[model samples]
Target: MRGRQLRRAEICLLVTVAAVPVAACGSERETVERPTVPRGMDRQADSDADRLAAEKAALDAYAGYLAASRAASGRSDPHAPELSRFLADPLLTRVQMSILQAKEHGAMRTGTLKSDPTVTSVSLDSKPATVEIQDCLDATGYRLVYAKDRRVVPGSGGGRHLATATATRYPDGRWLISSGAAHQDQPC
Candidate 1:
């Protein structure tokens, strides 16, 4: 019995000693070697990434331009000739229609009001762009007067209505206003 017990103790001690050496043999962190990339492959990857980034930037700029056009004042029918000159293609036509509608009938102010965004300046996508716009008119005076039933008649359109516009890059590489939105409460 004593001999057997001594043998078991020796085996445990040997295992513990072997385990200590094995654990100390390797580092806790693994060292990985980076693979070498071919020059042509690297260049191609970089170029593709750059192109993608440029496209993304152009799209973002287009969207922002449209947002501004919708929020800013729109062209006035009183100066229709001058406004029409700047208003080109389908985009301008839509703005004209919106202005006319505002002149004819009042707009609706729905629940959860969100004011339109005004774009300061739109850098055309290298010029020659296509643009589009969509918008809704509001009659509310921004909580100046409360009550849904309380109809606060809007004053005459001052002169120009702020328009939100979105320009998109056409196939020709020109930036055009693809969309626009405006509230024609007051003339501009």
Candidate 2:
């Protein structure tokens, strides 16, 4: 009995010692604020808090993407470099292509684009983890117009509509808008 007890104690000590370095080396996303959680519940608190942070960051990235797109569209700039800051490859390519088409048609987007976005789902366990967002997009104060004369383009729309997006976490720890869609048919 004494020998078994000593072996268990040694194992526990080894585990505690091994855990210290691993804890210290946790990834940035795992770094949560020191919460007021009770001693044993710290892990739960940390996970919940980290999830909330990821949600907020994803929404922020969505806003950044919109703001950057608007800024570029207002100038009819197809090659607007700012879009890269908030967007990743395939979507980036598609968005730039859309802007190029708009510029080619001599049109520009102008005015305000307001959005109320919520995190619809979070998949932290997925490879490259992602957060899904649903937004009630209010573009009533915004418009697409002919650049040369500043006249509203026919069929250019503004209203409350549904929009959805997926925000993916990059290896570098930045959340970026990876995919999205605006639902013109579904009024919000």
Candidate 3:
């Protein structure tokens, strides 16, 4: 019985020793490194990443514009300096004019103006990249308030507006809205 027990212990020790080489071989196979990207492919990947980053920046700028517009509705001055950071040229002028008109009529909006913008397309091949965005405006919670008595304006029910805007990226990597048009009573 003692000899048999000794033999079994010896067999177990041998088995463990034999398993070490098989485990080491498996780890060696796993340690093999993956192939590196080719030089041309690497450059292409960089370009793609840059393009995607620019697109995201443009979208962010558009969102900023929407926020500015919402805030402008509550202010007497529609051409707030903050709005200029996101808008440029003809579009800026148009928005400013509209805000001025509303102010002149003693109209101000209260509550939130929600906007959801979607980037339909982006073209970054040119110096000034162009981006097209579709925005869904929800003014359902917004209320038009009169400046004189702070009374809610009549027929001021909030509605949905669908708008398409075009933005241009400047040399300084800033994106600004160039033009935009909206249709009232449209489904978001």
Q: Pick the candidate with the highest lDDT.
A: 2
**Winning candidate number (TM-score):** 2
What would the TM-score be for candidate 3 when compared with the true structure? 0.73
> What is the lDDT ranking, best to worst?
2, 3, 1
Residue-level lDDT of model 3, residues 1-188, one tens digit each, is 99999999999999999878867865645445534667799789888897788678778888888778768878867868988999998889998887788799999877887888888987888767898889898878888889888788898777888988988988877889989987775777
Per-model TM values vs. the true structure: 0.31, 0.78, 0.73
Where is model 1 more than 4 Å wrong at Cα?
Answer: 1-43, 73-88, 104-167, 170-174, 179-188
User: Candidate 1 — worst ten consecutive residues by lDDT sum?
Assistant: 139-148
lDDT of each: 0.46, 0.89, 0.83
Of 1 and 3, which scores higher on TM-score?
3
lDDT of 2: 0.89
Candidate 2 residue 4 Cα shift, in angstroms, is 52
lDDT of 1 by residue, 107-166 (tens): 322222233433344333445533333333342322211123435335522223544656
How displaced is residue 71 in candidate 2, in Å?
0.3
Clash statistics: count for each candidate? 39, 0, 0
